[model samples]
Target: MSVTAITASTNSSSVRGSANATTNCLRLRRSHILFGTEKRYLSNQCVQNFRFTKPSNECGQRCIRVEAGWLFKGGGEQGSDARLERSESANEDILIFFYQLDLATRVQYALNLEEYDIAKQLRNKLNEVEAEVIKQREMKRGSSSKSEAQDKGISLLRLRADLQNAIENENYSLAAGIRDQISKLEADSLAATIKAQAFEKAEFEFRLGQKVRHKKFGYRAVVCGMDPVCCETSSWMENAHVDQLTRGADQPYYQVLVDVHEDPNLLVAYVPEENLLAPEEPDKAKFDHPYASFLFYGMDSAGDFIPVKQLREKYNRPRHEVPYDPQQDQTGDDNA
Candidate 1:
């Protein structure tokens, strides 16, 4: 073989090998493109299958994985559909947490309210019990007061009845004793009544004064003096005595001078103080004039008016007739 021919042959063989290698490289690139197109179509088909699965239990898990990958790659479907599903899950979790917290708070509030209501009920019951106790005590006091009043009234009535019986039977000693008892009762009752009245008047601001009516006396007398009279003999005589007088003998007499205001011609009459009233204003017209008049025609042996002292002596004297002497009559006839 020539050198030129061998070199041409080598060059031709190299060109042919290079041409084959280039063809294989083109074939591998075409295969790679086809495989990539197949993968893209499979991914699109998977998405379409997920849309067609109608949210069943089995398909839901697959949908979650596919959508998660798509979101990580930042590609596919604008993410609106998958976002809706994720939002629903998040909302469900939030609702569950809210329910738990709300239930716990409600339980605590209910317990507090129940305790408050129980406390209020107990307070009201205590108030009722206290009021009942006060009412019972008042009732007991009223009953006791009524019984005491009834007993006292019965005793007073019996005492009064006994006093009346003693007075009717002329038992002076018994009557006097009863009178003392009655006086004591009256004083005690008066004192109690006065004390009660004073207490009432203090609260009500009552006035104190004498009250009167004009029909009878037209004036009221206040009890200015309450002096009790002494029962001694000396006090009695000092209060009730007449004048002591001496007669012709050694006998002394007590004469009381009586007053005759309306009649000057009438003399003073004497009486004992026991038989007379303490000299109040008297009716003068009743005593001054006599109801009947007697005129005597006898000679004026005494004056027309007779002193009360001598009237008793003259009234006791008997009438006497003058006797005629016979010797005196004969001597007178001879002289004639």
Candidate 2:
């Protein structure tokens, strides 16, 4: 049947697997949301919209969704109109994340096979990826913050002008309303600046792209994003049992990509920092996730996924380099 829109909701099931690797099977409830007559389905990945010409098994599969000419959005009138319905940031981040993951995976595979030369080349490439991630992050921060501030300044100027016009016209009521709006806008701008500063000062125990395990649930996950403090609503915080934690919901929270092999339905998870810990040893095993292909460049010697440049920039995270271990190559060679 032709579909216009679809919504998914997740429900938890009995945990499965080893005690240290338990996972909840999440079931999605489908519902319809009507947009234009164009058929669309909710995507499991960054691709938010889809059009299907035929009934296919791939309907519910995870993928990075990109519309035709997505890059051209906001380039012209048609582009400007389409911008209202699409966000390019998530799709771009997924593409970059996949690249990093692929590179890291190849590096790990080469090392596992005792191909030191190939691993060396991949390692060099990993360094290059890290540099690019740092560059992109700096550029995003420089440009985004500047643009946001400029936009806010321009808006304030226009509102002030309107307030002046209202007063000149002896429209006291209109002037009062405009003055209130201006005050609120200025207050919001100040709050934004404060928030940005807080983010810069925020510290966390975990870094982006680190591999971690759930202390309570025993699920393996990789860090993709983080907040200085828990940012969920009160209701969500209660449901998540955040109140019971010794650190409470004031601690850092992370956006993690769950291993699909463990729980295919639990794609992206927002977890508290207190609930996560770095693995005791490097996990050499493959980490299976639908978004892994696009969200990470490669696995490091430490078994952590290298997040793509865009992904790093999205969270304002710095690039991380795996420490060099000369003995690692010798060990691989001995194994070979």
Candidate 3:
């Protein structure tokens, strides 16, 4: 036999092995996503353009590795396009597949684990995955008929999605710009609520020490406080930036030490009232915050937070003085 024939045969076997491995990985990833505790969404818009087969149990109830690069959609359903499609979407597929796996397999353990560093790494992975998912959806939207059909008219849905994505990705500069555009589009809505109002208004009624869920920031801690209070002096100001503090003066804000954050000790949020909502269940979730001890002396039988002795006394004492409203500071009042 010729040397070229032997070398070609060897390469063929290696390529077949690699293709099978990729298929198994894809199968495992699909199962993980389908049975996830908190299901991550898979958009039909993503898969609609492509034609693919379901995993077959005929393969010994084991993995059904589809033929090489069969999952990818190439233009026109023809020949060498197979090779080109693999090269094109390989990075995107790997990123998305691993991202789905992270959502399914890593999150529960990440939350349960006590080790700070490992949990943080897991959380950062989750954030990256979530950001990728949002970017993918946004890109899909941009390429759809809807974007083209708009003909320069504003799509508030797209704008809102982009704004939320920017905020979640910590793109503060971009968020600010998007926010300004949204305000302009919804100027009438803002004008309606622009009359006399309190510095902070609770969209949902809840007191301090209650458990609540934030639409963006997830579970635990409801720290209701005076608007624009000086948290820079407290441990609760760990992730608080000037932009976050000054961003939503017209809305109520909750001061919270978010549990299971990258830095549980320092990752506090002044979440806007609009973002706050009741937890899925009424049973209060026990959260451990480093500053909780300083703020609460102990929990009562019903698990309510109790203020420290000296702290409550200082506030309860009568002062023949008007209380300071930090929200007024925006109107050029500095005399706190």
Candidate 4:
């Protein structure tokens, strides 16, 4: 079973007062069977009110630690070692289930289960992942020169990390072994953020961009962005431009963004491109539109602005299946 499935099965309890003992025993056996292990010594009294998570531990130390190849070691026996070695094969399944959890979620799960030691281990794992991410960023930027590479270990940029090195140092053989370790770290997590999010579908000739100016707003003013009108467009525009700019209406219009010289407040006017013109005094125009960073990735060396990543990561994040989590832990899990 998956970790989530295991957690759910372990956490669930529904039995009559008379049958509680029988239910607990049966369930415990089932769990042991599922884990491919014989039952460990657990008291009947403890089984009566059993919970997968720790109920009371003032110091909040984890009672159990799940490791990849740990064989329940302590007493030396080759037979036990053989059994443990066999357990490792079974435990590989458990490790894969654990990793399916989001990094933050795994930490929260440990903390909520009162597994502080496990949480600490996960925190350490987080640091390693973050270090790998920073290293990848540096490697992509070619920051690992000879001296710098010696100072920081061989940085892996992933996907084409080896390719970049091979091309740089001209070693094609090792480059062929490149595997994309980056797929795990590239947490776009911005699936909700729409790309090049143009607000209106009104057929217009000029592609909406900054550096455009409002005739009445004067020289310093620039078109920062366009948005959809909630109600009809504001009636402030001189009757020359249609007032309404809501989406999906006849002659749908855009709420053009423009800065006012006198008032520092953001000014959005519902109008067509005809209502605005290119900045007459190009020298005075400001291309540093405030919304550009959120909308566009930084400009390339060629002076051309690049759009942000259009493709997004999956949005279906795992939900908390276990109950009885503390409020603070629950809040952190919500963020995860």
Evaluated with TM-score, which candidate comes out highest?
Answer: 2
Per-residue accuracy of model 1 over 260-292 as CA lDDT, tens digit each: 222211111112212223213312222211200
In model 2, the Cα lDDT at residue 307 comes to 83
Model 3 Cα displacement at 232 (Å)? Answer: 10
In candidate 3, clashing pairs total 0
Compared with the true structure, all predictions reach lDDT values of 0.26, 0.57, 0.39, 0.33
Global lDDT for candidate 1?
Answer: 0.26
Question: What is the per-residue lDDT of model 2 for residues 35-99, given as tens digits with 9 covering 90 to 100?
Answer: 11121222311112212122222433333222221111112353232122121232233434554
- Measured by lDDT, the strongest candidate is 2
Model 4, span 105-158: residue lDDT tens: 556766776767656665775555446444543332223322343322333344
Q: How high is the lDDT of residue 320 in model 2?
A: 89
Q: Estimate the TM-score of every prediction.
A: 0.18, 0.47, 0.28, 0.24
> What's the true lDDT of residue 257 in model 4?
32
Q: Which of the two candidates, 1 or 3, achieves a greater TM-score against the reference?
A: 3
RMSD of each: 67.0, 16.5, 24.3, 26.8
- In candidate 4, which residue pairs clash? none
List candidate 4 segments past 4 Å from native.
Answer: 1-202, 219-252, 259-263, 280-289, 298-336
